[model samples]
Target: MRFTSCCGGAGAKTLVLVGKAGNGKSATGNTIIGRRVFESKRSLAGVTSTCQLETATLSNGQIINVIDTPGLFDSSVEPRLLATEIAQCIKMAKDGIHGVLLVLSIGNRFSEEEASAFASLCQIFGHEIADYMIVVFAHGDLLEDNQCLEDFWGPNCPQLLTDIMAMCGKRAVVFDNMTKDEDKISRQRKELLSLVEAVVKNNGGKSYVNYLFEALNMSEMDLIDQTSEVTCSEKSHEGKKFHIKYEEQFEQLIKMVELRLGECIMRLEKQLAEERVARLEVELKAQAAQTKSKEEMIEMKERLERAEELSKKLEEKFKNAENQSKEKASETIWSRMGCIIM
Candidate 1:
């Protein structure tokens, strides 16, 4: 993979762009890779027709494998099948896919489809994939009606967006695909680089930091809610504020590291689980075939034993007939002799 901005990280970072259909995931992929690697065209119905692997190399030498998939939540399609396709992509890109960009249209509200996609991510990559994910809002300029994207997704928006950001570690950026913006892309790439570096520094950095931050965030919340008024003073309050900020910044670095590590581990575990499941399925089929073969062999053995018993009975009857004929001939010979003597 070409990385123009070198962080000298340990491994290649695979950035996956995922979203609902017609959300411009393919286009954003083309923009980042600096070419139209994926097939993008408008059709009568809202759908991205490219369901194959499309890859390109960036100027930075990063190998960008952009998987153009069918719409995640098409009303006409089966949900389980769509989920399977997503799973296939995940397996294919399991080697180095480091970042996940959950592309969202700035103008459109987050829908149940988007929520379903989010759930799929959690299901496929575990709840931790959200940590390495960036909520990339496409068509940022459309949010001009809302005055600001931040304000619109601010303190009073629906819980879905809040849940998304919270699950995604509140790490998000808006990208105007119409304006052909590159700023957010660059920022995203840099953040990815930092994450890679941190992952190299400590293999468990991502998961560890996330756990640490969750603890700290909980503690911060507790400090505000659980403390008695008499126990806290004005000076102590300011000191606590400064301490929280400092601790947060310190923990932020740790969290970023942990997030990357968590991503790496999650990818490995997912791949292993997939492999294990496939292997077990194959073994089961083979065992069934073997069992059938064993049953056929037992039936053949029984048939052979019955044929042998019938053969023995026929030989005994033939012997008895031959002996009777000999005895009768002897009696006839004796009678003829007696007649000749008389």
Candidate 2:
């Protein structure tokens, strides 16, 4: 990550781009920088498989820092790997982000998986991410009859997009990613900058601030204090006029966070329960094997005892027969002695 602009602070703005694979996230980043800094090509998968930072001086005089990230919520990417990459992304936005461009393609299906990916930023980085977020629709040329984006806004549009618009204060912009016209580019860029300004003003001219990475450096008590501040700050800030319509949306985002957390806990508990059942099944089998061995040993001991008893009876009978033979021999010897005396 590098910042090449001459000035910093108020003159600068940081934006992060997030979306599913092949959703034109990289193209949006390129368009933002006024150059093809990121590779935009036809593909079924994401070209930027990791975080890439690029900076440029926009016509609006804002030094824009764009962090283009991979499809973090794509099914192909491992969750553990995605977590590491997302942390890297937050590190790049160390100064806090002024805008989060949730990119999506126009005239395409927004599946539930993609919707969750759209919502995951709030779920992972805390609901504060939504305060500075806006949806940018790529491939704007796909609209039929040269229709405007607003015309595609009502109930007739995809429900996911509608829900997403409601989440980000209905702050969205359209772009033809393939368009090379400088005038159109400048116009769209200004619209995007205006949206960014709204987010910044909503936060009292401050960027989106979160302690996810900062918490790693703080002590337990310090982290607790930080969390307390964040919780209190969330309650204290009702937001500026820019966010007035979306106040309830922010509240809903918090509730969504709680629901997501609850869902995670339930999944973990169910997993643990399944593991316990599997372990108990294994233990029961071992116990049964041990019991069978003990029973076999007892049966062998009883069979040995019966064999010994029969041997003892045979020995007693043999001894009695020997004694009777000896007595008969003695009587014969006495009869022979009497005959000799006569």
TM per candidate comes to: 0.49, 0.61
The top-ranked prediction according to TM-score is 2
Estimate candidate 1's alpha-carbon lDDT, on a 0 to 1 scale: 0.60
Model 2 Cα lDDT, one tens digit per residue, 52-161: 99999865466999999988767566555565676667667766788899888875677766776765666667666777789899988787666888777545687877
Predicted structure with the largest lDDT when compared to the true one: 2
Encode model 1's per-residue lDDT on 1-342: one tens digit a residue: 111122234334556677877777776666656666776653324456535566655556665555566675454665445545554454445343456678877667788557755775565455756656767777666666536666766776768778887887676666555554476667644554455344334434222122333443455565555444435466577667766764665455445434544454455557668979999999999999999999999999999999899888899988999999999999999999999999
Shift of residue 211 alpha carbon in model 1, Å:
22
**TM-score for candidate 2:** 0.61
RMSD of each: 20.0, 19.0
